[model samples]
Target chain A: MFEEADPDLLPEGLSDRLPPLAAEALRVTRAMNDVLAGHGFDPVQPPMVEFERSLASRMAGTKRNRMVRFVDPASLRTLALRSDMTVQVGRIAATSLKDAARPLRLSYAGQVLFLKGNGLEPERERLQVGAEIIGNDTVAAASESVSLAIEALKAAGARDISVDFTLPDLVDTLAASSLPLPEAAVPAVRRELDAKDAGSLVAAGGEAYLPLLYATGPFATAIEKLAALDAGDAVASRIEGLKEIAAHIDGAARLTLDPTERHGFEYQSWFGFTIYASGVRGALGRGGTYRITSEGGHDEVATGFSLYPDPLIARGAGSAKIERLFLPLGHDRDAALRLRTIGWQTVAALDASDDARALGCTHVLDGKEPRAL
Target chain B: MFEEADPDLLPEGLSDRLPPLAAEALRVTRAMNDVLAGHGFDPVQPPMVEFERSLASRMAGTKRNRMVRFVDPASLRTLALRSDMTVQVGRIAATSLKDAARPLRLSYAGQVLFLKGNGLEPERERLQVGAEIIGNDTVAAASESVSLAIEALKAAGARDISVDFTLPDLVDTLAASSLPLPEAAVPAVRRELDAKDAGSLVAAGGEAYLPLLYATGPFATAIEKLAALDAGDAVASRIEGLKEIAAHIDGAARLTLDPTERHGFEYQSWFGFTIYASGVRGALGRGGTYRITSEGGHDEVATGFSLYPDPLIARGAGSAKIERLFLPLGHDRDAALRLRTIGWQTVAALDASDDARALGCTHVLDGKEPRAL
Candidate 1:
């Protein structure tokens, strides 16, 4: 049994949204879905709680241990609140959507909980809006997902947005190289190489790996540099795919390639990218591909991104255009009914004049005197 | 530490929606917001987790013991995932939105978690879409919220819908009457009345309470009967308010009044209502008025409702229409890009003819033929 507290103290890290701001956030999330749906992405809402073993067992490394877990009294089974939507999406795609068509494009918007320290310093419940494309393994499908993400972000009012592209193959190439590097020396190699540390790269993987690490830069230049390197077949194949993606995007110059940049769950495969805006310190959204092995011997490729909307709003993105109309006090109920019937957004107030300004009314009607239309 | 699995098992209850259905749910939830927003309701989104203390303490009866509780790692405090949106809305109204203008009308669509048993027996996680109005306590505001809910449901494509209204004061009226009843006997009395068990009502509350209990019928007729009931001041005031609401709705023929309809959290005051549709035994949505008394002597009133959209969708209420365009193998990439730029939802396929029908595509363009558009 737990001791109850006095009512004054609210649970920490949770706060309520008031009228205008709350209204705006909801509007933005809806608009995001509208854009996504228009592009053929469908919505899927999963249950918030799931079997703890199913969620945490497969998750690699330290992240899984942070999930909030409890026992369901009725089932007497351990259940965990969903820590992320992608994993849930993966589960659904593998199970319920098994016999469905390949290249399934699903989108979702919901609140996902994570144990503190996964991302944000003081973990807060985040309102995440995201989309996932499963079973599509082609470069064209991947590029389209990226394009749609940019368009959706723009539709959600994100301005000056840019996408930073990173290839997982670049990291894989470095790891697979015949460098007699000790395990402890890997982090330093990754960091220094990411920072373009030539000396550190020479010290770790030797002068042979320098050109490949140094080739990382803006998309086009990096592609050309990687082509020029004496890289093996795997590295060369990755470069070709990256070039194809760069060629397909309308403004390929805006895309940056960072060979050493690695972010995302360890499960990510090829073609990872992040969306960045001015005020947002972290990526506004992030995603990559992961392979799911089905019941039989089939493997499905899935990729998607989730947007952290609170920071976007805090950065002055996604403010709703509120159109308010005020009806005068003592207005005829029948007339108000008529207005409602015609689909007008209205507020009927006793003190119409005061309420109009407070509600930010764009249009106000006088009840005292009926005017001609 | 946790045992590792093969990652084949999908977390229970969570789902991934395929095209058309996922698209349709998005459309329904969006349409709901459109209708609510048109009725002067602003949208709001609250955190998915709250302090277990804030949520449980305010819940007056059995509900306090049923919330899903877990320790939040960030705050190192016990937190409960929100079992319902109403309590979070109340906390916001009492604190954050306290200074906002009176009669704060807000709307929301999100996932809410309930402990295994409270009401929804087998299913615990639910997608709740609802609206809340805080501050001013008026029959008109309550009626507006109820009407908006009905309109929203209808817009979500619910063909058969019914709204059931009940007065909370009637329970107080029966309790205060000299109808000899023990504390535990009250729920049974209320249940019998709700089920219209006239014999049970008479046996429990006696002949004096029969008039009020049996006064359940069509909204208008029930209101008329309540007006004539020889009840105390509390019951009479509540009855008068119901009459006023019935008069305003005009289409009182569609409304049903069950004086014994006892549903809602303990904090609800005044009128309570639930929306029901075909194929769903439980109410598709439920909400009512709530008055909060804080430790600092602050008092606030809020009324709202939440819709369980998953069940509504399960009953085949809201689904989306989807059209897919498939581009054939060896198709001109430039042409596909042009089509996509012009707003066509296109998926480029290698060997398109083989997968076109399986992709649920209505139209397919062969890359070999330039004449085919």
Candidate 2:
């Protein structure tokens, strides 16, 4: 398919991150991970490849299509590189930490390779940084995760992130409720809600769901708009849980509410959030509560978030600004050590004929002192 | 294939590096890359997957077998996950940086997945950290790269590393020399040399190659022993070049010489060195002078090194020691901020019923005072 491309070129949707940029990505990842750790989230690294059973269960329908799979030469079993980290974290919580205490806090940051890219990020491979707190169903757990996500993003230098909170299982809840969406009409109505097409959703779900259409805006306005509608008891309880989570968040980031928002999020369940950096077009990160099923098929509650910091890194945060100091041939090694200790990066001249500047040095050692050239 | 193992279990050769270990690996990678960058090695992160042509050439024989490969869905061409960074660096040196001025210094660190682990490192995936100096073949360039490698290892907390120098292509060099190694006996003699078997090499290649057997142990004894041998001009010139590179290195790491040693390294053209940390069983790293071939087949001289810092990181570097501080529900946010600014990792209590210490905090804040609980 890439007939015109050089064989050495990267596979489509993949990229090669170089200096300054590579360094930037690392910096952002560390900053966010450190913030998670500060909040009692311990880091866990999963393998790049895992058996399809461990990685594909919760995300079976959607994730399986994007994973790069192959037969393991040693084991001869089907193996796939993870397209996402959430389900893997779930698997980890279920298996490795199976016997651990309640509310297990785990954090991770690594590269994930997708066979195909999604609409938001067209790159097949991306660096994903995330934190998950498992086995807690309380609104407090959801609130803490949300606040920490904002703090982590802020630590990564993302300013003015607007968090749009929504019910992840709203589509399922509506389908089960008395909304009378003949199984065939549900997909169309869900698509309209995902598109935020007000008129179209009303035409599909009818007049009773009009409040869902008006439920887009600030949390204060959206909650009252939703309160005005007669959503069944089952849906009402979910909305109350959303309210509790919202009330507990202390406005660490810009907070908004979109009750009927349901697209792009594959695993979120109870209270999901989509975060957008001020000027960036797509969501910077996503997180929510979801049911974690154990290897024994017993399910429990969990909440967490995953962030793709490329957009934050794109704005040029945390790049190295230090220029190197060159030690010309025959320069004192002791002097170079002293210069390096005092914050100058030392690049030694390899040959007597080499010019320091030509060798990419910004400063050169003259006698015992460094002089800017 | 994994019929008896749990579904969540990793393949036999893979592993999950949790918390402290994962953090340690990242720290060691950053430390080594920083040292490389200090020496004018601009960082270049190649894609995790590349066309087999870019990664397998030059390393055409040995590396191809170990690479985990598949047909790319996008390109419809065979693609392989990189098993080694050395050849990919060579490709970068050839294409993207073709016009990069003489002595191009580049550095990189990333995860490489292998189809099967080498005998030494049984894990299928490893973090490979390295730096390459392309374009100059002078002894001074080799010296600089060696010195920088030791300095980087030191930064990563590895102690007492010894560098054993050997000519990578010495067997072939001797095979082509006036010393008649019977074409049939060459492979047998080479195997003996690899095993450090002096008696076997003396039997096959004859008594003339006795010094090759004697050229073992510390650099002082081995170099003098080899110099005393009746070696022809070609071998003598190569030894002299080794001596020149030696003169430039000031013994930052223990130096030894093994003129006949040739095994894991298949890419080195001249002046190859293997690194060993005291008490570490396997080679910590390997690097040497090599010739680069562009896509058009134009050749250029280059030298560099690749380090497997996982051994160094195994010794507890960069694991966080600071315990988190717990801010109980209703605790003052300003007080928590003050504590955080003073090196405390503050984890806020999510609910009134939460026990701070149970949530993994060492100290809990009460009335603006943090108390050990």
Distance from true location, Cα of B194 in model 2, Å? 2.7
- Report clash pairs, candidate 1: B24-B320
Kindly list the per-residue Cα lDDT of model 1 for residues B1-373, writing each as its tens digit.
2233334443344344444456667767778888887768777777787777777665463275567777766556777787777666666666666777877777777766667544445556666788887775567666666766777777776756777888765665567673546777777677776667779877775456677765777787887787677666777777776766666666622678877667563556777888887666777777677776554466877777778776656655333344556777656767765655566566556334347667666665565322222
Per-model TM-score on C-alpha atoms: 0.87, 0.92
> Model 2: per-residue lDDT, tens digit, A1-373?
3433455666778767765677677678778877886677777778888876677776533468788888887778888887788777888788777777666888888888888776766788888899888887567788878888888889888888788988867767777785666788778877787777778877876555556777778887887777666668877887787777777666666678887776655667768899988877789888888788745675888988888888788786435566778888889888887877767777776767667776668888899998889
Q: What is the DockQ of each candidate?
A: 0.49, 0.57
lDDT of each: 0.67, 0.77
Residue B16 lDDT in model 2? 75
Per residue, candidate 1 scores C-alpha lDDT tens digits across A1-373 of 2343345455555555655666667657877876676556667776677777656544352165667778767655677777777767766777778777777777888777765544354445677788887786566666766777777777666777777777754554656664435667666677666667788777765466577675665777877876787566776777777777667677732787776567563566777878876656777787666676543455677777777777666554335465566776656766666766666677766333346667656666556322322
What local lDDT does model 2 show for residue A293?
A: 73
**Predicted complex 1: DockQ:** 0.49
Inter-residue clash pairs, candidate 2? none
Q: What is the lDDT of residue B66 in candidate 2?
A: 85
Looking only at chain A, give the TM-score of model 1 against the true structure. 0.84
Give the per-residue Cα lDDT of candidate 2 at A251: 66
